[model samples]
Target chain A: MPKIVDHEERRAEIVAATMRVIERLGLDGATVREIAQEAGLSRSVLAHYFTNKAQILVTAHQTAFAAVRDRIAAQRAEIGDPVELLRVALEEAVPVDARRMLEANIDVAFWEFARHDPELRAIRLDSHLQAVEMWESMARDVQAAGSARDGIDVEAFGVETQLVIDGTSLQAVLFPEAMPPERQLAVVATHLRRVLRQ
Target chain B: MPKIVDHEERRAEIVAATMRVIERLGLDGATVREIAQEAGLSRSVLAHYFTNKAQILVTAHQTAFAAVRDRIAAQRAEIGDPVELLRVALEEAVPVDARRMLEANIDVAFWEFARHDPELRAIRLDSHLQAVEMWESMARDVQAAGSARDGIDVEAFGVETQLVIDGTSLQAVLFPEAMPPERQLAVVATHLRRVLRQ
Candidate 1:
């Protein structure tokens, strides 16, 4: 191995560049050339990594989901309490960083493509499933921690939380002034507390 | 006067057809020819009503919003409780009829176009503003009814509700199995109950 670079880490770097292109130029302008330019690599090198633009978008989404999942899991370990964990995990998805904002932009871009592109649709569905599963785990953990009320449907609750988080992300993106981070987090926390069976 | 038909009603009918065309075909597919064909009218006649496709999409969105507003306003007379009235109004946006589905499809189509079209972006921003205003009205009603809790930011609450509704609509379209009508309503109720001060 010349440098012994981590394949996964390099892939993530390229994906992050793809997101920057999306944020600056919408999906219409996120061409392979532009993405490669943003990534500081030649189109040939980018092509070597990803066969096409769709593959690049899909890979970026996969990497974003993995990042989110790992971030939440790590938080789960740090915060042993269910309510606190739920609040923290939910807030993590909000676009608090350039990376999260990039994730949101890429997500919105792919959604339009999903309507007409089967490959994009499959990737979007898989991402949603992964999110739901992660939330499901969080819900179960909350219930087990004794913070949630008895008779709570962890699966259903997980779905509900996912809906709110997803919805909040969209709103924050569209109307950042109105849905500031503090306000979004507060609204989410209040709603989450109420969903508990108590 | 050749019968002097209700211009507003006829315009709405045409806009409704616009939504149907968008639902069947993607935004790019919903051209003047297609809409005119669907509306059972000549392209010239459609042009007389709306100068271009942009105007048609805007009018269709207006018509959809009007239907939602009228439904909620009408419910206001029969229902005095703010929470219950808001609940019913929110549920009305869910996919209860083909019309609602068509409206949602049109929204998604326009959103896709908005990424590339400035006029459509303005329309979307206007729609979001109108929604916020409508929610503020509902929030005020809740407070006036003495059901709202103290220190609740009505505007923020309104924005959050809109986010949930928007999110629900997206989910209903993308993952019908996961976000059915009954489940969506339950989540709406959960949010309402949680945020209400009383």
Candidate 2:
């Protein structure tokens, strides 16, 4: 048997290919056959990694999600202010650029399936909860630093912040003309100020 | 060959059937043939009503949108307070229950197509523009009454209000446990208070 490292690498390759297919052709076009073609693997080999289309898609969703998280982590290294770091993360979360736009596209694709798939819903909920927790941790730092407004419900603020990210990304991805990237970034700024007063 | 009224009635019926198929089976399951079967019409008759699947889907989107608009209108008739009316309209916009859940499902299905179809994008943009105009009109009333905060950008506020609606509806529909109807309604309340103090 191959080492676990190679096993993980193969899965990552398939997930990346799934994203590419989904990105170019939308979710409906990303059939298992098409995804296998994009990944340059046989259906049998692909099946070994993922049990079904939904499983492949759930991993694809996590891939885009991880990219956003990594980008935030990279940017957060230079920023000392928790509120500023949170702002940057919120901005990174949305489809403000081609990279995040790809992520947003994958996310929208996931939402269509997550609507009906109970397992996908559970996976999405877990991811969303992690986002809330990450943001809440940063919010606590901001709160303790006395940068946030008085009586701010840090928990609600955390959840709402993620909601804004989700909502903004959906609009910006689906309706770029109406909610352009610049306007979206500006909206995030206003949202941050509303809660952080910074 | 039918009368204009009959033509419109037939189109509305087809649109309704399309939505039912879409809501039950999702956009991918919503086909020209399935929609025709759902409407109790032959595929040829469906063709006579709508030239293509995209046309039928666009009309289905309009049907769901009109439902939300009508529900808001019904409630607005009794509300003299613009802010209060806006709050109710916002609440009506999201999928707080079964009826609006159906509408939200239809909208989400439409969104999947709208992400790729230029024709659908144009139609969606037109519909969104009208919603912004309606909200701006109400925002003007709120501003005139001095119920809203000073220096509020009515145009931005109008656009952002719709963004919130889109975002909130999406989460409520896809992640109902995370964003229950009660929690969604409460978020809307906080959102409205942020915009309109009274």
Q: Choose the strongest candidate by TM-score.
A: 2
- Report the TM-score of candidate 2, chain B only: 0.87
- lDDT digits (tens) for residues B35-101 of candidate 2: 8889999988888877776776777778888887787788778999887888778788777888788
Off by over 4 Å in 1: A1-13, A16-27, A38-52, A195-198, B1-13, B23-28, B40-53, B149-153, B196-198
TM for every model, in the order presented, reads: 0.85, 0.85
lDDT of 2 by residue, A146-184 (tens): 899877778877777788887788888778888888888
Clashes of each: 2, 0
Evaluated against the true structure, the overall lDDT of model 2 is 0.80
| Pairs that clash in candidate 1 | A149-A198, B149-B197
Number of the predicted model whose lDDT against the real structure is largest: 2
Q: Candidate 1, which CAPRI tier?
A: medium
Quote the positional error of residue B23 for candidate 1 in Å.
5.5
Interface RMSD of each: 1.7, 1.3
Name the runs in model 2 displaced over 4 angstroms. A12-47, A50-56, A74-78, B12-44, B50-56, B74-78
